[model samples]
Target: MKNDFEDKMADIMLGEAVTALLDEDVAISWAALTDRLRSAIEIETDEDRIRAGLRAIEEVRREMHVRNGEKTEGKRVAALTEQKLH
Candidate 1:
């Protein structure tokens, strides 16, 4: 028997996972945007600005990868569910 806090945490985790999975297109767009940002960053003359942009791009890439993983997991889950239902 799960406690209320545990149940709430599980729900929150599940919601986050599902939301991440649903934003597959957004993740792909972010990847493209990061690529563009990298190109812009390359031509930047200001060292500080270049470093900041790189940091931001890395953060966004990390998130995009996470979303991509979630999307893959969601697809696998869907496939398994479909197989079970048939």
Candidate 2:
């Protein structure tokens, strides 16, 4: 029972770490993602899984970029501050 509990805890921690790492990879740097991908391919453990993860991250990034551009474009012709006459 103790061993099972410990295993579950480790799994949770590992999942959290991977999530954080993926966030960083998508937001700031892709080094973590690249390294993980290369390792996965080299080890031949689960290339399909690794590729899927990469594709998902890429799609999210693409959507974010598109949304950001739309937001900026929408604000381009809008006034930032209201003009008030005293």
Candidate 3:
């Protein structure tokens, strides 16, 4: 059984990322996550844990961009890879 704090942290992290993915708005997603991270201090979550959660949330956001075909960086990388392979 996870601590309630842990569950809430997970929810915030994933929820923010999922929302951002759906909206396809990176700026808004980052802003919301930053707000959630700041609020975590008020909720007594440790700094290390909050940082880890933030990193995970960022990863989720990036993955969402990739999956949604909104990753221009990924496309550039793919092109580079193809050029090298040829």
Against the unseen true structure, what C-alpha lDDT does each candidate score?
0.62, 0.52, 0.63
- What is the TM-score (0 to 1) of candidate 3? 0.33
- Write the residue-wise lDDT of candidate 2 on 1-86 in tens digits: 85465455444433543676767775534455445444444554554444444554454456668988999977764544332321
Q: Pick the candidate with the highest TM-score.
A: 1
**lDDT of candidate 1?**
0.62
The C-alpha RMSD of each candidate to the native structure, in angstroms, is 12.9, 9.3, 7.1
Give candidate 3 regions above 4 Å deviation: 1-44, 70-86
* Candidate 2 residue pairs in backbone clash: none
Clashes of each: 0, 0, 0
Per residue, candidate 1 scores C-alpha lDDT tens digits across 37-66 of 576568878765565556666666688889
lDDT pick, better of 2 and 3:
3
